[model samples]
Target: MWIATLALCLDEDYELIDLMEQMKREAGVRENCFASLGWLLHAKGEYEKARSYVQQLLNEHSLLDEPAIRLCYSILGGVATAFKEYDESLIYCQHVLKLCQKCGEDAPLPVAYQDIGEAYYWKKDYDLALEYEQKALDLLPEEHLQRSYIYRVIARVYRATYHYDLSLSYHQKVLDIQKKHLHENHLDFAAAYNSIAAVYHNMRLYEKALGYLNKALSICKKSLPVNHPDTQRIERNILRTINHYNRKRQYKVSNIILLYYLKSLKSDLPDTEHETCSILVRFLFDGVM
Candidate 1:
């Protein structure tokens, strides 16, 4: 369990999945492997597969002990968050919290708080998000690596609320910890780079944003599956940064006419409008305005 948890913290999804699968094969469903697998699958962006596995566990909820039940609820909470069912996520996470309280286990308390914090974060309840995330952070020792996860959640909430400096600080803290603990090419570095890039992007530091995003993309290509969602997301982010940078450049009459032409095609080809525009922008401008 510790290994799986640590693998997740490091964003080592491939290794985590393999470990969970091996656990499942050895121990079957009774060892909480299914619950762990569900959670890990969600981390890998296999949401439908995660839901299917976890829903199966839910079907057998009556047979589960309190710890197993809590685990299942925690996994469900994460899946709900991925689906943007924030209210449902909160309910599940709250249930996990209540279970953790009943167990009187300090070890599990932070996870419950973190889960609730994430749900609130996605709901755009930044104050509640920070409140719960701070509770989670307070539970950990200052040097505990797990604190990085809480820091990341807080950092994202700060970013969303336009607290860029605070966001960057927290993200840098995550990097500091990762640098101390993880291998140089670990996927967590890629995540941290992507997050820092987002801060720069929001600050309108387009060149800095592109530089960090390219660093992140390079890391992803080396560490993650070629078709991984994180890799795809970084690719999309690069394109978006390039487009945003180009749009802010002084436009000639030809550029204005070209944009108008694309806009006019939206109504005529609604389904392909975005793709058409993106392709045209890349082709006509050679990725520069």
Candidate 2:
């Protein structure tokens, strides 16, 4: 069992499959093995395959145990969320929440809340998203390792509501918590930096935004190939922000401003600088800046 668990974590899907086959041949298939395999397949993004195993486990003749039932609903809810079926996800989450409450299993409460929050977020109900996320955080133990996810969800909700300051705050909280638990170059850290940069960009704090964007770019460059979509997107965002700020009069006067602008024909530049700053002007016109 421990070997199978390690294989799952290591993402050795073939090894996990072989181990499960052997287990099935030897023991006539166990509920725990099916559940574990379901999670493994889910992590690998084979949602349908995972769901099939989970459903088989749920149909077992053995009286449905509390843990098995909770896990089944949780996995089903996750699959629904993955498919962007938020309403269906919420239904399964509600079921899981009730089961957790009945069994006095506080450990699953945070997961249930987080799933519901995500469903609301996908539904564009920012208020409900924040409400459920906060409830999840309140129920979660202080030392919970997944606290970064809660912070990230709250940050996303705040961003959707146009609360840039609050969004930045929660993103920073996620970064701090992730830094303590994850490696410096972890993808999660890069995501947190990106989120923070986005809020700063929305607030017109170009320099601060560029700083975090660059950090995200650096991490992506080190950990991911240059052609990776996320790395390219981060680079593009950094370039766009730099271009926007470069043509601004305030940024032009800053010490960090590029010296090439100083050598350019000042008389030919637009009087208000807005005309020359294509990205910022576009953002303003689009009501995004």
Candidate 3:
């Protein structure tokens, strides 16, 4: 059991697979191994494989303990969320919430709440998202590590609703906690900075937005490989902000049409067209075209 658990601790999940068969003969070992393996597979993006383990755990004959069963359902919900199956994810998360009630184990309730909120967020129901996230926030203590994520999610919902000040407030809350707890080089700084930059972008505070974007970009360049998706995404955001700042004009159909022709002549890429289109938007916004 120690060896099996250690395998998971080291993130050598492949080593756990062979041990699972041998552990199945043991009393408590097999279930823990299964749960850990399921979570590992999910995190690795092996969604189908993770689903199989979770399904087995939830099967009628399994009779796994309440906490174990709840974990499996949560993993199932997470996998669904990863695949953007928010409706299905909500059902699984709801199941976990029910389990938490039945077992008198309220500790997992906050996580279930967060999962529900996240599902609503992805579904574009900003109002519902805020409600559920606020529930999670209320349940979580300010000192709890997970509150950072809840704050970030709430911030995102506010941003989507164009509540710029509220979004910045929540994002600042996250930063306040993160600065005290997380190391300076932690990847979360990138997310925190990006979130702040987005709010600034919405407010048309381009200089502040650009500053935060650069901060995120710098962290990504140091922590992630240049070709990493996260790094690329930050680069894209920086480009977008720069383009927006350069085009100081309101939206005008006339400018957009001109941008389309200019883009067609200059570059065929849809993204290239978009970059040029922002310039046209600026012309319209500034009423200079």
Candidate 4:
């Protein structure tokens, strides 16, 4: 179990996932494997499967201990958040928070606050989102790796509220924390790059946005499955940003200004030649001559 915890923290998930599955086949170990297996599956981005296992854990045990219940709720809440079920996410996370309060457990408090903060973020309540995420951050030690998650949520809140500088600052903190724990090409790095790209995009800095987006896409390609939703999402974002850049560049060439330029050019050409060129310009600009 200690090795399992280490495997999870270190992102050595494939072997840990296999070991957990094997443990589930054994008799007494099966009961103990559920929460760990559920969390590991969630980390692997197998959300439906994670939910299935966690739900099974809840149903099989009439009376799970506090830690098991907290893990179960946390996994379910995270899956709900991934699926955009903010209300359900809030319910599960709030339940965990209440349970912690009743049990006088302080250790899970930061996790509960982070989870609740994320749900509020998706619900577009930026004030509550920042407040809860700040509470989570305050609970964490300065160098704690878990602070990265709280920093990310705060970054997203800032991004949504149009505070680009603050968003970038928090995102930088997230990257700094992740770099210390995760390898250079870790999928978490891809997520952080993608987040920073989003901030640049909102700031209308398309070149910087494109640069970060490309880095994120490269990492995703190296790590995630070909058809993974995250890979496809980054692909779509790249296309959208490219389109926006092209449109912005096109807007810089004012239609009236271009027509005036053409009129001036017409003065220096024969009427027949000018008419031919003007027709081409009109067709190109209006899609009809």
Candidate 5:
């Protein structure tokens, strides 16, 4: 369970899935592997699979009225948040908080706060997000793996608020901890690269953004499942950065027009069309696209 939890914290979704599957087979449905498995699928952007798992857990456990039952609610919140179902996520978070109130200020108390904060963060309410995240940070122990993830969230909040330097500082803290505590080439490291790239992009440091984006893409290619949404996102970021960089040079208008057309196609097309566009774009740019 610790291994699976740690993998999830590090954004190692594939590893978490494998671990949870083995744990479920060995320990059976009596354990909390179901919730962990559901959360892992949510992290992987497999919303339908995650929803089914959460539903199974809910059907089996919702009426139990135990502290353990709160785990089901927490996972429902997580899955909903992954799907951007913020209102539903908040209701589930409230359910978990009510259970925490009944059980005293135990571990889930902090987690409930964090979950609520996550929902707020996704809604672009950075102030409320920071408040709850600080509440969670206060409760989480210094060395817990969850603190690293919370730090990343806080970093993102800072970024969204336009505090770029502060965001970079916090992201650096997360990256340092990940390097110290997690295995090399972990997806969290890739995520850190992507976050920094976004900040650089916003700052109009195109070359720096491109460097971090390439690092992220390299890590995703080696570490994540093929065709993962995360990989596609990074590839899209790379193309955006390249297009932005090209916009400044004279004689680049034709290329820019082509790339802009491809971008429009990418936004409007299905995944199959996007894949075809990617191939065409690559052919036009000698694989740079």
Candidate 6:
């Protein structure tokens, strides 16, 4: 169970799979083992496998009360999110919220709220996302890892709502907390830098955006595998920002100019690599003449 928990938290998929198989063989399908396995699978984005185990655990654990039931809902919410079933995700999160309320202001309340906020964020409801994220932040235990995630969520909501300054503030809060509690090259640190850069990019502060994006790209390149989508995305974003500024010199540019340029680029090249390259080529062509 301890090994499974560690593997799930660290997103070590192969280790979790091996540990789970050994555990199942030794324990003959225990509820706790199934639950842990389910969570591990969920972390790996194997929603079907996760749902199988989670459903089994839910079925076997007839006397499950607030804590255990809340855990099941949380796992289900994650699985639904992975499958892109935003409405289903929201439903499971609502279950968790109810369970939290029933548990009388319990430790799980913040986590439940966080899940709901993430669901709202995924659904593109920035107002609800901010509300739920703030609620989660208010309920979160001081100095907890969950609080870092809540701060990040709030930052995302602020960014989505075009509140770049507010987004940067929340992202910086996450960065400060993570720096104190986590390793320097932690993925969460990369995530924070990336998010801050995104806000800067949206605000048309290309140089500042490039600085943070490059930092994130450096950390991601070192820590993550070469093919990791996040690393690749950040690398492309850095290139895009450089190209964007390069292109601006050729024409009268403003925030509106950049916004329209990005919107047009979004249609042809949904992935970052193609978009960045296309923008760079356009910039070079415009400037060379």
User: When superposed on Cα atoms, how far off is each prediction in RMSD?
Assistant: 10.5, 9.1, 10.4, 6.1, 11.9, 11.0
Going through the candidates in the order shown, the clash numbers are 0, 0, 5, 0, 0, 0
Top TM-score model: 4
Q: How much is 279 displaced in model 6, in angstroms?
A: 22
In model 2, which residue pairs have backbone atoms overlapping below 3 Å? none
Cα lDDT computed for each candidate against the true fold: 0.77, 0.71, 0.74, 0.79, 0.74, 0.73
> What residue pairs clash in candidate 1, if any at all?
none
Q: Stretches of candidate 4 above 4 Å error?
A: 1-32, 62-64, 103-106, 253-273, 287-289
TM-score attained by model 6: 0.66
Q: State the lDDT at 283 in candidate 5.
A: 63
Q: What CA RMSD would candidate 4 show?
A: 6.1
TM-score of each: 0.73, 0.61, 0.65, 0.80, 0.70, 0.66
Model 4, poorest ten-residue lDDT window? 22-31
Which is the better candidate, 2 or 4, if ranked by TM-score? Answer: 4
Q: What is the TM-score of candidate 3?
A: 0.65
Clashing residue pairs, candidate 5? none
Ranking by TM-score: 4, 1, 5, 6, 3, 2
lDDT tens digits, residue span 1-289, model 3:
6435534553554543543443234213244445766765564456787788678657744646666777788889988887779899989988888877776644467777888888888889888887888888887777676788888999999898998989999898899888877767556888899989999999988889999988988886765533655667778999998888877443345655676766566766687667677776666557776
Q: Per-residue lDDT of 148-210 in model 4, one digit per residue for the tens?
A: 889999999999989999999999999999888767777778889899999999988888999
